[model samples]
Target: MESRDYMNLSTDKAFPKLLNPGESLLMSLKVIKFNKRNKAQERTIALTSTSLLNLKGKKLQRRMDITSLGGITRSKHGDEFVLHSPSEYDYRFGSPLKDQAIQTLCQAFKNLTGRTLYVWESNEISLKDLTTTKSDKKKGLNKMPAPETAINFRGEVPNFNEESKDSRGKRSRTIFAATENPSAALLDDFTILKVLGRGSFGKVMLVRRKDNGQLYAMKSLRKDALLESDQVEHTKTEKLILQHINHPFLVKLEYAFATSTKIYFVMEFMKGGELFYHLREAKRFPEDRARFYAAQVGLGLGHLHEQNIVYRDLKPENVLMDEFGNVYLSDFGMAKMLGENGSTQTFVGTPEYVAPEIISCAGHNITADWWSFGVLIYEMIVGIPPFYDQNVNLMYELIQRGKLKFPVKSPVSDNAKDIITKLLDRDPTRRLGAQGFNEIKNHPFFAPIDWVALEAKRLPTPFTPRITDPLQAENFDREFTDEAPTDSVIPENKLNMILQNQEQFQAFH
Candidate 1:
């Protein structure tokens, strides 16, 4: 492994062993780390790689500096550039080095490494031209190559025009969510800090961007599994929903991209863990504390409804908090976007939170969120859903019966009971927020809430999780932490089928 600064590259310096283009070399970079004040600098870069891809049979150690595969490509932010190939676009250099500048670096490579005629080595001509140049005798232009030592690659010349362009181009990106300051943050932009959680299909990983050291949650889903399980549409739905919605109380999709095998969604890291984890430990929350949490969720849901989005899944597990106790709604696998007066008859949602309309296979709209809100509040107050039962059918019956039964032991307030009652109404038309969130926001239960300040995150939370570090996983379930991450075993036949039908999952990127 070599540790060298790109700025200090000189042909006279002895370079590391030169290998074939595709051969995995243990690449490292030299960088200067400094505090926010730009003081106390350290000239070093981490010996880490963000890519999970194995080059052939060997591991490829990638870095953001020194040298990158993707050539310097223009960015939407004018001269701002991202360098890397389109296929294995591993590293995106956020800034520095341009066309002619790249030629200068290649000169350094030639001087240090001792090679002649580097293939696709010039910025003025396409890489293909390097291998075979057309002869034009009329113009008296001679086919001349750079003399002596050169670098060459087995693969075709990288499309410099589209090098920075990801699978999701600017137009495709607009199909999902719009961002004021869109994330140029690719999946490879962040190094995997830890495996946060994993399921049958994919994983939620803790990642830190090399450029800014900011932490985020990266959810990598297997495209093959999504296709095999017939969940391609669900995956697309989640991405589209996330792109359209953004709020402080809602988890934001910072960036999204996909590879041949996996799809990734980069999101804000909620360090406080799932609300269910805390609820299970405490048994239940007091009215005031529950009210505070519920209000935060309501604001999030209300905003979604305002955008004509219905959060079909609203449970404690999806509610996450930051170190400051600011709660956000995460996981939009079941959320759907409907136009004004638009509705869907999708029988989706967790059994407990599923509205009667959804279970009945009748068309449902934004009103469905109100019912989930009722179940969530009930669980917060009583530590158990109102219709808790060992039998699934019995639970469904309880929900359909529309019976408002409260535990005798619970000293529920009139305002609390009043809001829950209206929300859990069997008739979707009569439910709180049916007309809009205005009906629910005006309820006495949330009278203390200042809509503006709440949105501004001015209200003090009742509880802040004991999260001193973003990497701390104490609040999370040990089962997930302790379990070894199992690899996805996709049958070759299934993978081929998914590729043939790749158009179905196009929205995922």
Candidate 2:
């Protein structure tokens, strides 16, 4: 049966009442609504002077007050628009007559609230514009505040002071006032050199600071995509964790700042690139070499667990190496802070490395990272994960089965196999590192590792990359390095539209 049929039957049984009296409809149109899961459903949107109603036939599905409307934005290349609501999740709708629907709604909103609705081309909307009122102006909201000359890390504000200085040691500063272009003001200090990586929502580039000529990796993410996907809170959490934690085996965040359209994270550049790249070239590593990398990663995870932060994502791709082949855990996007003995129900992690508890939705804690660590160690010695399968569902079933097997002719020691079995236990309570990281550190497989010397980085590295120059991209994938490394220019009008939404990223710094 069609999905619309299900909607009709559901609405008929729940809501039989029609529109309220004196609330006449002004415009009714068939539209597609994108729900929280991003699935599209057919519904009728009726716009009135007092409210906007979502309906199926004569049954009401949802009603939004017109007076409470915040803002409206139209997509650049489609008949789609997002209705911004400060008090609830933003509503996304698409219609064949999108222009007419938006025009009629905006007219009604302005007539009722005495505020003009500015339709932005992009999906960005300003909450400041939505929540501000004439009464707020009476409270002196129009005054200009003092410029910030010194660096303040309390709120994670950007280091604008660094950008304000020149080669001559002279300093000039701007207040980042409402009329100024914030993106150009902040990003102009760095010269983009190459594209380091790309993902669905953003890209990472190798950039150089103009003042000291130091190299760094700058990650840029789109604000609209983050909001549409409901990842705003996750992004904020990742920034906070990165800002507070400082360990030798963990990647360090040097700076974080946001523009009207994007957020940027400046991090120390790792010359040797991701461990995954080198692992693929070498196929697999010897037991001793694998132990070296695993020990460092264990220490990194242990440090995070000590701070009550769970590193939910752990895999070869996130393990980065320096020129001397020292590993550092990167990408804390999935990490979260929990209260004492707390567990989270969010289903996240790479499919192959996901823990059994996460798959069953049983709630997970720091022990989940131990499961992924086991998978990483097994893959490092065997050239692939223990339960790896091309079919994701079957692979998950294998993981839940909690079976551990070694190749018949493999050279892996008994100590290695024993540790893997304990860490891969189906019961999180019985996992090797469930009690504390010291259990894993004391395992016989890592007996050769001098824990004290390793943690201090005093021991010599087992391997080193053939790096001839600091600026060379030989260690990184050629596909990313060959691409043009230019930050796209935002139109002046679009920039203004994004500036209005700066309140959403005030803590990005």
Candidate 3:
């Protein structure tokens, strides 16, 4: 039997005791009860851990009751609110709801022999019998504040079959806030097939337009996530860039929609997956193969810079290609629009691919993207990043010093190394800027590259898929491997929720 199968059959009940020294399980706590006026009755109180588990999938909320309460209350008289509860009394909590029955009794004793209350014991075991204290409770006033969540409705409102329009009705001009874009609606002709990716913000899906049966990629981000990350401006900036810019090498935005819960972007789907996964699988590409991809990316970056937009994140994962071998730059989630002088201050980028200036939290321009391009080209020729370390701190220090080394045994040409050296120059001013790509294109490194022909998607790809089936498990490689297999925790429910929610999201507009 497989290891996973064995695990499924095992019922040792020892998993909960597997914590190592100094390791502890942390669970986010939410209030299960509220006091009068719908406020948190008490800031801190002890409750059984099992009680929290009962509220597993429920959102935290408050309720109010006008009845009497024994706990000390905080009112306008804050100075005299503090008081000690009765020393020899038993406190209790009662609930009238069927599923919400709660009873917590606390008996305060002044000392060992101060007082005693007689009560007959029932033969049944109590919760206190099962509770075990490994150590004394840590002395501290623990404060837990509930997180604010912005709702992104996941269902659509029902529509009526009857048309409400009259034959001679007058139409009035309606303007949406800021831009005159239309509200979001479901494209009845398209079907969402599978989830492409998911993150804290939202998710991406593989969709097929029923009109032409053409596959397209759709990315959806919840407005709450944007608001929480304080990246609302960043998302808006990407929308603006997508609106004003038009380039073949860049991922084209087909359409966009905004709902109360999320914003969706429909774009051309790249079936070839991430460039990173391809490079990892092939080990390393030949110099010509590397140059072909690099040149296409550089051209795209150059076009973006010309339009005054900076692609802050330029790692291989953000670069994509279609099944036909046409490459395009994607992931504008971290992109930024340049100021009047074409400048930006935000420090953002993937660590291995980030420019040194960005690491130091200093300002940089389109030149930063070129530097990252240099690192990418180097990585393409070699299987590993130029400066990688097991320790991330050491890696950051090495990057700050701008140190990149190449193996002598590697068959990469000298011209490729020269371009890398120029691009990796620590000084941003002399760091082979946007025009450096032109210099590289004319170099002997790309002697066989017919730039004009390649841009038109006519050039043949050096590496063709030995396996033609798109859904083949082996064809997915590192990119889709995790999603290809299903055992436990396969994210099937999340995907279903997203699909069902998409319908609701379409109507939420």
Candidates, ranked, TM-score: 2, 1, 3
Instruction: Estimate the TM-score for candidate 3.
Output: 0.59
Under the 3 Å rule for N, CA and C atoms, how many clashes does model 1 have? 12
- Give all candidates' CA lDDT scores: 0.61, 0.71, 0.52
Candidate 2 backbone collisions, by pair: 256-509
Candidate 3 lDDT over residue span 1-509, tens digit each: 01111111123344233333532222221121222221212121122222111122232222111011122211111111111122211121111110111211111111112222111111211111111121111332211111121011121211213222221111111100000133233545467766665544565676777767877777777654444334556666677677667777898877777644567777877777667667767778888788888878877888887777788788776788777666789868677778887666665666567788875657888888878888889888986667664333344557877457887888677888888888888778888874645765676666778889877778887765444655432333334345633212313323543454344343224
lDDT of model number 2 = 0.71
Candidates ranked by lDDT: 2, 1, 3
Q: Candidate 3 — which residues are off by over 4 angstroms?
A: 1-189, 434-437, 466-509
Better of 1 and 2 by lDDT: 2
Best by lDDT: 2
CA displacement after TM-score superposition, residue 506 of candidate 1 (Å): 3.1
Q: Please report the TM-score between candidate 1 and the true structure.
A: 0.62
Clashes of each: 12, 1, 4
Pick by lDDT: 2 or 3, better one: 2
